[model samples]
Target: MEQEKDTKSNGDDVSRLEKYKEELIAIHHKSQETFEQQLSYISAGSLALSIGFVKDIVKDIDCAGYRPLLGIGWVLMVITLLLNLVSHLLAVKFYRKSISEIHRNEFVSSKSDTRFDKITWLNWTCVGTLVLGILLIIIFVNHNL
Candidate 1:
């Protein structure tokens, strides 16, 4: 009878809906944990590493409150910190959509390859400048002394 057929279809729909609902909850739970991990743990590591590097560099510069060398090191540390924050933010935003192949492809498309190249170039430039500045400071101080 048509009534029997209708009842069977309804039961199927109910079971399917329940299954999907459970799957969705699991995906959301995982996404939330991943986001929190990046924002908290990963970012914390970057913060500590950057600050520690600068702190070590400036260990003996307490007397020169306005030392340009220390300032440059601090600037590099801050730049590195900001880059890590941005990367973590991107990873968090993509964590949920990361389930879909299409979404993953979209994420890959959105990020610029050239941007990473430029960052590399800038890093090298900054390092070169730092070395030059240190050499200049040593030369000038040595001559003066």
Candidate 2:
């Protein structure tokens, strides 16, 4: 029957949609993990490299004039690291809340989730601060050289 065929086709479409949704969710989670991990590593590495550069390479130069720039860069890097940590914690809470809501058959969209919003903001802030910190460090090194 044509009607029967139509019903079967609709069911197939629904299942395919569900499969795609699951795949997308998995990819989203993986990308988030990668972003956070990579950013943290880069920020920490930058801090260490800056310190080593000053101690080993710029040892003879009087860095007092541009020291404040380096100090601010260090502070920014620290803040980036702290914000990344807080974002991780918030992400955990968000996932827990999402799971609970799913178990309860209550759907809360990510746009309306405060924890999700905070995580998003924290991620942006971390990137911004890291970039600013790197720029400051570059300026400090240039001045010393």
Candidate 3:
């Protein structure tokens, strides 16, 4: 019957839409993971490079005036790294909670999730701190030079 065909077509469309949504979600998650990993790598690498620069390149130079700036930059970098780690853990927790909710037939909305909000805040904070830390380090080095 034409009616039956229309109903079947509608059902197929709904199923296709669900599959497309799932694929998009997977891609989003993958991109987020990649972003976090890169940020972590950059933060850690910057910290190490700054330390090495101070130890080897500026060893004899008395950067006493700008020492505080360098110290603050180091602190910021550490904080960024810590925040990244915390955000990653919170993301895992959020996903686990979401999975449990799905299993219970409860709809989980990311917009209403405090954990997701925290993760988002932490990620942005990490970006801010990392940029500030790098800027301070650059200023310190330039001033010393």
Best by TM-score: 2
State every prediction's TM-score relative to the real structure: 0.39, 0.91, 0.86
lDDT of each: 0.51, 0.89, 0.86
> What is the clash count of model 1?
0
Which ranges of candidate 2 are over 4 A from the true structure?
60-64, 110-112
Relative to the true structure, candidate 1 reaches a TM of: 0.39
For candidate 1, write residues 45-120 as lDDT tens digits: 4346534644564345444344564455445444544554554455444444444635456545344444344444
TM-score of decoy 2:
0.91
Residue-pair clashes per prediction, in order, are 0, 0, 0
RMSD of each: 12.1, 1.8, 2.1
- Give the clashing pairs for model 1: none
Model 2 clash pairs? none
Descending-TM-score candidate ranking = 2, 3, 1
Candidate 2 lDDT, tens digit per residue, 1-145?
A: 9999999999999999999999998998999999999989989998999999888888854644588889999999999999999999889988988888888888678544766878889999999999999999999988876
Poorest stretch of ten by lDDT in candidate 2:
57-66
What's the residue-level lDDT of 22 in candidate 3?
100
